[model samples]
Target chain A: MNVKIDGKYYSGNKGETLLELARRNEIEIPSLCYKEGFEGLGRCRLCLVEVIEGNSTKTVSSCVYPIRDGIEVLTNTKNIVNMRKDIIFLLLLRTPNNGYIRKLAEEYGVKAPSRYLDMEREEDCILCGLCVKACEKLGTNAISLVNRGITKKVSTPYDDASKDCIGCGACAEVCPTNAISLVEQDGKRIIWNKTFDLISCTRCGKCYSTEEVLHHIDEQLGVKTQEYLCESCSRRLVGEKFKEAFQNLI
Target chain B: MAKGIVISPDKCTGCRICELACSFIKNDSFNPKDSAIAVLPYDSVGLQVPMTCLQCDDPHCMTVCTVGAITKDPKTGVVKVDDEKCIGCKMCVSACPFGNMTYSSRHEGVVKCDLCDGEPQCVKLCPSDAIEYKELDGPLNKRKNIANLFSDVFGEVAE
Candidate 1:
């Protein structure tokens, strides 16, 4: 199907979303919550588009808007640009120190905060849900949104050690604002303030995976975890064992 | 892309984006109230579960439909509600064991998942693969009980 985006016609598939279509045509629309090959959600209003169908026109999220034939979509209009600026201004209030939000705001010439809108500087978590979603997608729902409204923050249950947390570090990897901190302390890795004990390789004595991570893996794969060796050591041992078995059989 | 949706409660993060996507796709607006899917959040236990139409082989909704408005697809085995034929009696809604069926205030009729004609919006929009659309190899069914009411909003977790 052909979708008219910014007065230019772009070819898209039957099930393509406006975000996917615009991105294919090299159209620039800033989105924080969208990731490649993963589904887009109701969060992140950055990819708004003015969808015009003849006499009717309304702004809709391009990230979730299903692309159809003969619909006119404007990526950036004067009114849309102004609206986006306000949204950026609000986001700046939430994650003031974040460079990603600031960099986008800078593109819109939103360099600094106005005197009347001064707020205290804070951490970078914008509550985009990418980290939480990434964790869920990785088969571990360790971290989630805790509390409500302004007090809403990413944390484990009771703000204590999480039993479901496997310490895969997928949450830290996908955080848009670089807010999630995964730190190693006393052989236990702390992710989102949840501590998980790390398992070490027997030969090299190098910590490879968390104990919970190994257990979770074992549960998923329906196999008993025989050894707790790092990837390389395990492979080396397997190779040696195979050679020894062959020699004995020969 | 085999049969129907599969819910893994452990993988759910209670984002409710699945609900948002379902509502928007159905109504062209974002409202969880109009959504076919609902995420029951057990915050005390830090557990989130996505609940929706399980599309059972012998569906209670289909059986209890007084007007015979609900029918199952022969090919995909998806149970669907035909609104044009529906009398709005809400028999199917009450008879539904999973409580997956709901009354849509916007549509003035009962609403349930049609699997989006085989490409479910909930599965497509779920950031976590908690809700998935695949071939059903076994009899994985959902039966609602009194326990669901407490577990959906808030339930205690043993420390």
Candidate 2:
């Protein structure tokens, strides 16, 4: 189906979201909470696009808005820009110290929300829930956005170390603002207020990953004989075998 | 011939100059954590292996990417992450069994070796000559040469 975006006709497949089509066409639409291959949460509201429907116009979160035949979508009109700016301003207020949020605010020409509101929140988390989504994808469901409204935040169940969390660091890796703190030092990996002993490679004696991660892989994917070896040690074994084979051949 | 970086583990000194060079060239920083190539030191075996993306014919990272952000170019055989489409999901990081794929917090994306755009910094800066950027078939040809010697000695048994 052909969808008109920013006055350009772009062909989009059925069930494709407007944001996906826009991005595929190299059209910029600022979005924070939308993750590819996951259901659109529409929580950020930063990807609002103006949809023109004959006599009426409506603003919809383009990340969730599916493309239709001959649908006219305006990505960056004056109204849409202003709305994006306002959204950025609100995000700035919520995450005053976050670098990503501040960068977005600067790019959109949004002033500091502290000046007008006279109130500043010290929290750096924008509650985008990308981390939560990432954790859920691991099938652990370790963390989630808890509470409601202004008090809502991403946390493990009961604010305790979740046994289900394998300490994969997927949540921290996906966090836009780097809100979730995951620390690794002294052969210990810490995340969500939980500490895990780093597993050492049997061949190399180098600490590589957590014990839980290996156990989870053993249970879920079945165990391999060289599972305990680090990437390089196992790879080096291949080189050694090649050397041995070459010597025999010669 | 398709080019690649081949490592001789015996020659590697575990100096990690490859990691530094790669991180500096790619990310303009000196952090090994952000480097595309990693040197894994095996202290027990007195061996070090410089590991990077293998540019597999069938990549696990590309398969696990939910958003289709990761693709392998058939012409170059380089697997790459499209930054615009990547949502920083880090699924590729977990999916790679060899731990070659890295999730860089600074870049906020999963990054792997692209052979430094056909001029590998790691191979250039490797002082020991353990890491070499050459034709992928170079080692295979050596093996084939030795195999031919066997054929010559056996005089091709009648099949």
Candidate 3:
């Protein structure tokens, strides 16, 4: 199928979305909550683009909309710029201190929108659905969207402890505004701390947060009497022990 | 007709997303050890070089494979391993120039990039457009352009 994006005719595959086609053609479109190889959640509305010749010519999410034949797509029009600026402004008013979000807003020259109502909560949850997708798709249901619209949150049910949480920290990793954090507690357990550090292993170069090491024996290795090592280290240690054991047995 | 992956160093921000995506797509988890793509970071220089299967025309890995498991895809020009025919040899792993090919612990066979069937997920997910899918000749020009753009943006590359 042929699609005209910014007056350039391109061949698009059947059932391919407009966003995917645009990306394949090297068209730049800003997206926050869209992750490739996963289900599309059009919550952020950051990837809004104008379909110039199609019936849906208004600002529509390119990520979710499939590419139709002969459709004219304008990715960086003045209206899209204005809408993105306004959306960023409103998001900034809700979340003021996020460095990532603030930087994105600054890139678009957006200031905080005026407060519409007094409806503000202690916690900031823009409901981007990254946490939910990370849980459901990744086979670790550590979080989910609770409550109905206007009250929905990417949270655990009843704010209780998650039984199936593998603590992969994918939820916190994907959060755009740093709303979720996996916290390490006194080398015993992990909890949601709202502050996170994307720590990497010094030895093997694996990515893990500080909270992931919370219940790990390595967390108490230095302080405690018994030394705890990671899987690779422990394997070497175990090999040495087995060698000694075999000699003793002989 | 061998296909190779070209990485633009100037565009790379050392995010290691390519490594993660490679591992996830191949291994079904986020373990970099299983990933065929390797990102080597030089902290002193603040630079990262992502190395992977080049699928060279005169492929060393295919020549070294004793059981003749490694073969080049005619259509995509990507080197792929016939896992069913593989004998779990380490010759191909040793023959790799970039040290990107590896023996999969799960499969007990050598694994490398198949370019994700020519629709590489890493190229799609890269935030800075650092990684791009193009013909072998096209990627070099693209990298040169990106380096010029980077030099213009950052003033000068650090020595």
Tens digits of lDDT, candidate 3, A51-87: 8664557678998988888889888889999999988
Model 1: per-residue Cα lDDT over A124-187, one tens digit each:
8888887776666555677788899888988888888777776767667556677878798677
Residue runs of model 3 more than 4 Å from their true location after superposition: A54-56, A113-124, A192-231, A234-250, B1-159
- Give the TM-score (0 to 1) of chain B in model 1: 0.83
Task: Please tell me which predicted candidate would have the highest TM-score against the true structure.
Answer: 2
* C-alpha positional error of residue B81 in candidate 1 after TM-score superposition, expressed in Å: 40
Residue pairs whose backbone atoms clash in candidate 1: B3-B134
In model 1, the fraction of reference contacts reproduced equals 0.00
The lDDT, on a scale of 0 to 1, for candidate 2 is 0.76
lDDT of 2 by residue, B22-93 (tens): 889988899998887877665656666667777766776676665577898877777888775575545466
In the order shown, the chain A TM-scores of the predictions are 0.86, 0.94, 0.73
When summed lDDT is taken over every stretch of 10 residues in candidate 2 chain A, the lowest stretch is: A218-227
Better of 2 and 3 by TM-score: 2
lDDT of 2 at B8: 69
TM-score of each: 0.56, 0.73, 0.52
Candidate 1 is graded, for docking, as: incorrect
Write down the C-alpha DockQ for each prediction.
0.01, 0.16, 0.03
Cα distance off (Å), candidate 2, residue A106 = 2.5
Stretches of model 1 off by over 4 angstroms after superposition:
A114-120, A238-250, B1-159
